[model samples]
Structures are given as C-alpha cells and as structure tokens.
Target: MSTPTGFMEYQRELPADRDPLERIKDWQEFHKHFSDEQLKTQGARCMDCGTPYCHTGIELAGSVSGCPVNNLIPEWNNLIYRGLWREALDRLHKTNNFPEFTGRVCPAPCEGSCTVGLIGDAVTIKTIEQAIIDRGFDEGWVVPQPPKVRTGKRVAVVGSGPAGMATAAQLNKAGHTVTVYERADRIGGLLTYGIPTMKLEKHVVQRRVDLMEAEGIEFVTNTEIGKDITANELVENFDAVVLCGGSTRARDVQMEGRDLNGVHMAMDYLNGTIKSYLDSNLEDGNYISAKDKNVIVIGGGDTGSDCVATALRHGCKSVTQFGTHAKAPLERDSINNPWPQFPNVYTLDYAHEEAKALFGEDPRAFSVLTKKFVGDGNGNLKELHTVQIERTVDETGRKIYSEIPGTEKVWPADLVFIAVGFEGPETPIIEQLGLAQDKRSNVKARYGKYVTSVDKVFAAGDMRRGQSLVVWAINEGREAAREVDKYLMGASMLP
Candidate 1:
C-alpha cells in the first residue's frame, strides 16, 4: 500500500532487545526502540489484502485466527506509513483501550493469521504497533479526556485487571460514574503481581491507572468484594454491577510431599516476589527466595517460563522446567492443527533464551510427568520423581497422555513451583451473587452479551470465560460495558 512493492520481497524485522545476561541482572523491560523512519518501513510491509484476515479476529478451525479486538490494522498501518501518527493512535485507541499493555505482552494472533505469513514471515505488526503507541506517549499526544456530561448512573467493576480497567474506562466515557475495586494492595490484579516486572514494569501500569484517575474513574485498592465489602452492598449502591474478577484459583498437583515447606503455587511465588520488590528490595526476604537454590518449576506454559526467569534473576544455582506434553514441532503441526489458524509450533521466547544462557541448556523437559515430590526430614522439598510419557488422541480426538514405563527417575530440587495453570474464578463472589455457572466453574454469560441471570448483574473477562489472555479480558470488559450501558439507559452510545 505504501509503494505498491512486491510482497515477500522485503524481510521481516523487529526491534533489538538488550543483551540477555545484562537484562537478567535487573527487572526492567529489555526492548529497544525503533526510529520513526524504521517504524514507517515496518508499517509499509503490511500487504493490505482484500480479505485482511489479520483484523477479522475470528475463530476458525478450532483456534483464534486474528486480533480478537478486531483492530483496524491496515487503516492504522497506512496512517503510520503516511506520518499521520495522531490519527493512527486515535484509530488504535478506538478498539484497544490500552495498546501499551497489549503491545508489550499480547501473543499477537493477528500476525499468525497474516496472509503473508502463510508463505514467508508475517508483517512486523506487533513491533509497528508498539512503535505507534510509544511515539504517542513520547509526543504527549496521549492524555486524559473525561466525559463532558454525566448520566448520574453509577457502575461497579470488581477487578482492576485489564478487563476491569477497560470496562471502567468505557463506562466512564459513556458519562457513567465508575468505581474499580481491586483486592490487591495495588490497583492492577495479575498485571501488578502474577506477571514479573522484567516483562511489564509496574510503573507502566501505574501510569495508565493515573491517567484513568485523572479521567474521573475511581479505584479502590486492598478491598476484597465478598469479604471486606459485601456483593449486596455493591448491587444496592451502583446502578449496575459488572464482575471482571479474573480466574485466579490455581490448579494444584495432588501428589506426595505437596504439603512440603518449599512447594508453592506460581501465583503465590510471583506475588511474593513483586510484593518484596515493591516493599523495598529482596534483602528483606519477604519473598520466596530462589537464591542458592535448585529450583524445579513444574509445567511448561508462560507461568513456568516466568518462574525460570524469576529464579535466574534471584541468582538461583540451577533451574529446570518440566512439561507433560511432547515438544511442539518448529514448523506447523498440520495433522493435529490446521493452517490459517494458530499453528502449534515451537517458539523460543525470552525466558527460554535466558535459561539457556544461564544453564548452558534449555530448561524445558518435554513429555516428563511428575509422579511425586520427595521431601527432606524437615518437610522441605528435596527431589521430584518423574516419568517421560507419550500422548495419543482418543476416539473423540482429544489429546490424552500416559507415562512410559521404565522411565521413572528422581531429580534433585530445593524449590518446587507448580505453574500448572488456573482452574476458574474464586467461587466466593459468584456464590455471594447467586449467579449461575457453567460446568467449568466459570460464570455463565452469553458471549458478546455479558448479562448474568441475576438482574442488573453482568460478568466478563476470566470470571466469565475461564483462564484467558489479557486481550480477551479487555474485549469482554469493553463489550460488557456497552451492554451494561444499554441495560441501564434503555439505549447506549458506548462501544
């Protein structure tokens, strides 16, 4: 679109990152910035296809194929290419409430569905996106704009994570009074605690919250909804109550030595570290210390990888990540997963690379199942017994795994972190509200229509969708805000 250039002729590129070892020594973002000219070149790479599946944001063939928020990718790309940065930022902000967060942490499903990536590399969409928002911030173009009129309708959002924040912002923009309640000492939920600072600095999250506060959105921290403030109180005080509380009840590995002293959930470990860092530094020992310890992280998802990186930063002696499923292939795995959808492929993210540099080997062990944890006399975890396994599809084509006989062995470990993922939202609030739930324990609500069974009550984000990414959470929150506005006003202008 920029110059009618031939597709696939230009190479894909991304901004440079800090040296791995240097970045691991501290908990700060490691990505370097691209010049305005460089970002324009990247924006020029977008093919602007006829169908433009990148912005379609549809689920096809059982996986997400594009940006779930349905961002206007080509329009913004063309804007950036022509140096209309303010217009590009406005267009971007229209759909994504916080591109700064997504630009930093989102997995970028849009790139995965890019027509160009079907053959060669995808457009540098994520990098270009980050550049645009960062430029907007640096140029002082991003500012707080509180609504001119008030609907006098009050709304309560029960979590200050991405979903809650977006919901509050949209509702506030629609001239409703919005109050966000966060259980943590800080406003952000997992964004402030579960995610390590190296990936996303807390100060960046604080900046957005500050802006929201300036925009007439109220935030209440260190207040649990069901415990400190009753759900009934919220319903009575606010015109509508929208639950954006995340799915944070962690799943545990019920095995021998699970009650041992050194065993901890990934959220607990991550939150402890963040609390310690915020309180002062690690010297106070308020957080779980991996220093001089052999850490064995269970599960191979992003949480496990985060544990590996956090341990390394704490100066751990050794770190290992165990996975029950076989390693994904470097290329597309078409037999199990199809094309034009998210392909199950191996990717070396930042954490894995950090572990490799620190230990001289990648920390992940594929197809290795933990049988039990071995503990010392003091009830501290000492070793883990595991067996390598294979997986096969059942009659329903669901993936099932079984242990391979004669492969059992014990591995030494001083610290054991279970990063096996979350189950669903904590049931206390749901029960308190007397809302219906699905089989998975998630709050039951129709997609795109977030109204719950209870009158004037709505559920969105992980609370409604189970464990999901921040992007989806934001989408749910914004869409829920629209529905809530309509429910209260009989008609809605909010989007």
Candidate 2:
C-alpha cells in the first residue's frame, strides 16, 4: 500500500466539471483531470483490500458487481501511487484493449463495489485510469505492436463499433488478417455517429482507429453485408466471421402525434446531429436542427439526457425529461439495490447539469407517462398529454403501473424526441446470416462461450448481449476474439 495509514486516512477527490453555461455553448468535453500529485494521492487512497472486490467483476443477484473485464485494480492503483504510470497503463491495456474510451465514458462499476465506499468515499479509480492512458498517449508509450508473423487466417468483423474494433485489434495482434466492415460512411460505428462530439470528441476515436489501421487491421466503410456485399461472400472468403452490429432499433413512444413532423427517435436526432456536425461544422439547415423550439425529451436514461444537452447546444427554448418510474434517492437504498453492487442512486451527468443551470430547475418529471402527443394543423407536434401513475407490485409478483384518475395534464412541446431504449440489433444482417436469435431478439450465444449455433461464426457486443455500455461491448469483443482465435488456431497465446 502507498499510504502507511491505509485507506481510511486518505480522502476521495476528482476533477471538477467546467462551467455549465460555457460548456453548453459548444460540443466539447467539460471534465478536467486532476494534477499528477493529486492522482498519486488518490491512488494512495486505495486500501488494496484483501479480497479486492473491485476487480472481481461478478454478478451477485442478477446485477454485475465490478469490472467486467477483471482489470488488475489494486496492482495498477499501487503502480499509479508510486508514479509508475507506464507500468499501470501496461497492466490496464493487458485486460482492456481500449482504456481511452472506457476511462472517459464507462460508468465505473469498479468504484461502486469499492471496499472504501462502504465507510468512506470510493477511490478515484476512473480518473486514475483516464490519466494513465492519457499519459501513455502523451509519453508516446502507446504504439501499435504489429505481429511479427502472420497466421494466414482471415477474419471478417461486421460493424466498426467498439465490439468489432476490439475483436479486429485482438485478432490482428494474434497474427490473423482482420478486416472490419462498417455500413456507415465511416468506421467507429456509434463512436463516430451515435455519440455526440461534446461528451466524446470524434477525433479521439479517429486517432485510435488510425493506430489500428497502422497495425495492419483493414477498415472498410460504406460496405454493408447482404446488401452492398453478400454474407455468403464473407463466409466463403474469410476463415471466420464475428458479428458486432449494435442494437440500433430505437424504442419509440406509441402515441397519436408520433407521426407528426417534429417527432423523432433519439438515435435519429443524435445521429443526424453528429453526422451534420462532422459533415461540415454544423452548417445552416444542417440535419435535424432544434433551434428556438420547445423540446420535450421522453425517457430518463442517458440518451434522453443527451437529447436535452444536444437541444441546448442548438439553442432550444426549453427541455424536459419524462420518466415512468419515480425519482431515485440520493443515498444508497440497500433494500432496492444492495451495497458492494451498482447503486441505483441519483447522479447527474453533464447534460442534466446544463439543463439545471439554464432552465432554473431540473427537467425531469417522474411517474408521468405520455398518453398522447398534440400536434398543430401543419403536421408539426405542438404539445403532450400526460398522466401520473403509482408504481406497485401487483399479484403474481409483477410490477404494475396504476394511473391516478385526476392527474392528467398537457404540456407545451414543439419537438418530441422518443428516447426510451433499444429493442435489439437491426434484423437485416441477422436475417442475412440466418443466425439464431434469443427471445430478446439478440443474436444467440452462450455468455462465456460466445459461439453461435453456426460454425465459424461468433457473436459479441450489443448484437449478442443487447444494448449495453461501451466498456461491456469492448470486453465482449475481446473475449469473443479470444474464443474465435482459439477456434481457428486450436490454441492461441494472444490475450
């Protein structure tokens, strides 16, 4: 341990976010990192618990507890405490192929299950992880290490998202010729399009993709299977195929005015915004502008919050987020979601902070469901009809929502964004491959096995696991690549 007094002696501290108003004016990262000395102290705060539940990454009652990739947390923390950043980054990259992405975006479960958090604040693990990778980039320690020898095996990775990127990188490092196919105009799938430039700048993703390209991994954009290219051709040409298509089918609100001109799915709005921003500096009349409009974003998840932030950037008049469930408590509620596990507590992201600053109040409305949407005569959405409901467990042990009879109300809204969630991967590619799908409509694959019903075909990421965070997608991709490499070579050394 770095500190002689151990974990309780030191305290938890993180970098502050930029001014909310200033950050809302542009699409750029608002978070600032801690200084080197501060990071070292934060690292010293880790107790290096005997059990080290942070890296266990296990499911204890239907929920994941720690880092899914089983990162060597304590070892890296100690390394950082000693200012051994290069070594810490080495350990980090050993388990995670893309720490730069995860370090920035991941909802760090490792910190949630932290032993220190039970009594005191959790260790600043996420900040340290980001610092290590940033140092690696700054010190020129992170370079592409191409395999000295080629195995002559060819692999096709469909979808250039995190899953396909990780799989291709690992497979290429294992001496296989890997080619990633992306249907979009660019590689990096959601990283390039779905995610806004504010939270995760697109250049960061491009830099990593460039490095992967230098390592001899081929990226082919604007080429889709079963349409532009055939799945049969892929199976016949390549030794193996890994499907990484994400869950893109947006869960929409089924209401009367959903067909109105101003109503749109969250993905379409965000994707269009990112695409237009990337296409040319968000030119006038660029795709999906929300200028001077009253925007009502339905749903309470990250996507809904993103819509709020994006609308603010576009200078929307107002923003509101609707949630079916009641507001979460600020502190941990063990009976609902126990400790040493992901706490379902209230935490505000960048978007919500901006909304609070500009709108003079939080934009969240809980326990309210949109019954129908109101639209103007010109086919543009105008408002929303909603009602509050009480959540209770009904007979047969199922959660039921009961509407309050007199709670119906209407709110003004010019643009309505449906940001509920995703159902599953788009069916075109799945149907093209004729892959077996689970009841949830995800590509069928055993959790650890990752092997599909068909031979020489593997599935991973959102396509296999359904909608999840980028970190989980990367882990699934890496693990799936290992399984695919083993299947092809009958015993591989690449990790």
Clashes of 1: 0
In model 1, residue pairs whose N, Cα or C atoms come closer than 3 Å (at least 3 residues apart or on different chains), thus clashing, are none
Clashing pairs in 2: none
Error of 1 at 423 (Å): 1.1
What is candidate 2's lDDT per residue for 1-495, written digit by digit as tens?
778665767778889999999998888988988998898899998887889888888877666788988888888999998989889999999998888887888889999899888987888988899889989999999998889999999999999999999999999999999999998998898888877777788888998999999999999989988799888788889999999988888887776877988888988899988888888878845678788999988898888888999999999998899989898899998787877878888877788889999988888899998999877888888888999999899788788999999999999998888999999988876787788999999999997678988888899999998898888888899989999999999997866
After TM-score superposition, the amount by which residue 278's alpha carbon in candidate 2 deviates from its true location, in angstroms, is 1.4
User: For residues 102-208, could you state the per-residue lDDT of candidate 1 as single tens digits?
Assistant: 88988898998888887888888888788888888889999999999999999999999999999999999999999999988998888898888888889889989
* Local distance difference test values of all predictions, in order: 0.88, 0.88
Evaluate model 2: give its TM-score. Answer: 0.98
